[model samples]
Target: MKVIFIRHSEPDYSMLDKAQNPQAYVEFGRDLAPLTARGRLLAQEAAQNPLLDEAEVIISSSITRALETAFYMARHRAINLLVEPFFHEWRPDLDGLNYTEVELALAHQTYMVNDGNLPSDSPIRYETGAEVKARFLLALKKYCQYETVAVVTHGMLMRQFVPLDHIDYCQFVTCDIDL
Candidate 1:
């Protein structure tokens, strides 16, 4: 089977100041935030790809950003869609920190870290990098039972699995594997 994994578009904080913590989203709740105006336009451009024109099924992470990105593509192709929480962004606990603090916290971690094994005492529910990889592999195996599937999820999720040097803000990669 053929599967296409597409990372979601740029987030509002993509342009935030260095002091801001962009990785704060590791601890986000299940709120469905709409795309920024530019994000919407980027989604449009991503949807126009010729390969996407042939997509058979569209699946997305339950998170708002990923869902919104998938919705845009579905609208363009007039396809039915499915939301899978297994594909949701990695959720972590970051309690008490205001928005600004979270952003700053993440900036330091993002470049210094490739993966995380959250501490056992973490207050919030967090998935280890290993857990994230395993879940994604499971979802991919389950979804590939169909002929062709398109998955829209967070860029970090994609990076954990696929090695893209310049990770596309909203980009698609195709691969076939037995696992």
Candidate 2:
């Protein structure tokens, strides 16, 4: 089987900051961030790839950005679109409060230094690359019947399992997998 891992287009993160309920945004509303106009247009353009034409199934992260991108990718195609949480972004463990980019970067630094593990009493642990890859592999097993599968997900999560220097918006990496 062939798995096409595509990163979602640029998301309008400013929406999260503008949200009335920042607490809710920190919790789950973060997943509701939509793609920017440029992102939407670029995603539509990327969907024109002939490689996507061979996809028998289109799987997307439950996040809004990915789902919207999936719709564009599907276009008028008759392929089935499946929303799965396992394909979601690499969510970091954050306090239920608003945060700045610098704070997030510091937390990430701490997470990396600890090797994704912290003291049992510590409240600063994050998911490791290994953990992310495991879940992604399991998700693939669920749809082994499909010959070609297109997954629209976040770039961070893709880096966990994909060996690439960088993954830009709407970038796709194809891998042949035996299931």
Candidate 3:
């Protein structure tokens, strides 16, 4: 199976500060955050890249950032777009009071570099690396029928399979697997 994993662009996280309930935003709003103006522009430009020319289908994370990026790419190509929860970002244990933003970033970095094992004292008991890889493979298998499946997802999630130290906004990498 061949998959083109694209990371979504910069999101406008400032919206959280303006939300009626800031605590609610802290708990669940990250997934709902949309892309910034520059992110939209980047997505539009990336949509025209030749890498996406042979894509038979576009699969995306249900999160708004990835979905909007997929929408930009799919609209011009007229390809079918499907949302797969398995493609969503690896989540942090968001017990609003237990973890600090800095700790969240550190934990994610630890997870990515250590292959998903957090320190014994880590506040975020995130999903294991094995779990992440399994779900990502499942999405690939499901879309293997298509000649090419373009996936719009998150950087932390793509790190599980993509061979790169840094995955930038609107960046994409290709991978192949035997079904």
**TM, every model:** 0.73, 0.84, 0.88
Q: Report the lDDT tens digits of candidate 1 across residue range 90-113.
A: 544335443344553553364225
For candidate 3, list the clashing residue pairs, or say none.
Answer: none
Winner of 2 and 3 under lDDT:
3
Better of 1 and 3 by lDDT: 3
Name the Cα RMSD for model 3. 2.2
Q: Where is model 2 poorest over a 10-residue stretch in terms of lDDT?
A: 94-103
Q: For candidate 3, write residues 81-165 as lDDT tens digits.
A: 9998879887666354545567667767878667677668765677776777887887767776787789999887787786678
Top-TM-score structure, candidate number: 3
Candidate 2 structure quality by residue, lDDT tens digits, 3-66: 8989999888787887686655753567788999999998989888888888998999999999
lDDT of 1: 0.70
lDDT of each: 0.70, 0.78, 0.81
Residue 144, candidate 1: how far off, in angstroms? 3.4
Worst-scoring 10-residue span by lDDT in model 1: 22-31
**Cα lDDT over the full model 2:** 0.78
Winner of 1 and 3 under TM-score: 3
